[model samples]
Target: MKALLTKLAFPILNALEKSEGSYEYSPSHRTILKVMGFLFMVISAVGLYFSMKIEQWAGLFPVILFAGIGILCWIVAFLGSDKAVSKLWRNRNE
Candidate 1:
């Protein structure tokens, strides 16, 4: 069982580590992460709307799950690199 679980988890762990490593404070990488985060937020919004419309309380679980993921993505995109945040602030001031 442990071996099976390890096999299942290894790829996910590897992907996450690889993605974390890709955050190199580059403008392009920041833009991509921000865009992905926004997309996740949009998906979460849609999920929320459908959940409310259908009045399925059970459906809220998935909505909340997506919202959490969206929030996480946004947090990572914003907080992953101090340099990216500083660059954004500098651009805004100009």
Candidate 2:
């Protein structure tokens, strides 16, 4: 029971821990995440505009696209970015 609780809570804790921004993850990785996030927002905005200007179905497409990209960014951000950055720094400083 404790193990199960820990397993579930660990992911949550990791999420909260990762969010602190105090750790200063690798700049390149952070940049990539930021760019992807920005692109996702921009694409979504474009999609929304097109959708509004066109058909309801078309407008919804941007919403889906943005959500998908946002999800992709979250996944990439969680799995990577900071680690890659720190590794690069370690190499350069050494």
Candidate 3:
């Protein structure tokens, strides 16, 4: 299943998994990333609900934005390698 998911999100994974230098990583980074993803997903859901309730198409922008970000977070948090997670977190000390 993981292999299949990794294949499906190859584009995103490929970009982050490429390592050029040393990076700092911690287990908590992945946990925090997953939490952030879940929060973003919740925000997206709320935006979608409000958009429908208000009949305002403009709200779809945020909905899409949050959803895309959330999905990216989830994909990286789960399917991506440690290097990818480190990349996503970026080289803080650099």
Candidate 4:
């Protein structure tokens, strides 16, 4: 299942995974990333619910935004390596 997901998200993972650089790693970073992803997903769900309830197409903007961010966060947090997480955090070695 993880392999299949990694394949599915190849486009997003490619650049980050391929970057050449040293990075600082922390277990907490990944933990916080997962937490933020879950929160963004929750926000997206609420946005979707409100959009449907209010019957307003404009609300979909935030829904899509949050959902996209949430999905990205989830992909990186779960599928990416420690290096990828560090890259996302912009913690490349100086």
Q: Against the true structure, whose lDDT is highest?
A: 4
Q: Residues 1-94, candidate 2: write the lDDT tens digits.
A: 6556446545533543344223445556656765777788788878877787876774786688796776555444544445433442332332
In model 4, the clashing pairs are none
Once superposed on the true structure, which residue ranges of model 1 sit more than 4 Å away at CA?
1-25, 82-94
lDDT, residue 20, candidate 1 = 24
Better of 3 and 4 by lDDT: 4
The candidate that wins on TM-score is 4
The TM-score-based order of candidates, best leading, equals 4, 3, 1, 2
Candidate 2 vs. true structure, TM-score: 0.46
Worst 10 residues of 1 by lDDT: 15-24
**C-alpha local distance difference test of each model:** 0.57, 0.57, 0.90, 0.92
Off by over 4 Å in 3: 92-94
RMSD of each: 10.4, 8.8, 1.4, 0.8
For candidate 1, write residues 25-81 as lDDT tens digits: 456655666787788778878888888898877877877787776665555455534
At residue 61, candidate 2 shows an lDDT of 66
What does candidate 3's lDDT look like per residue over 1-76, in tens digits? 9889989999889989776777888989899899999999999999999999999999999999999999999999
Superposition error at 72 for model 2 (Å): 5.6
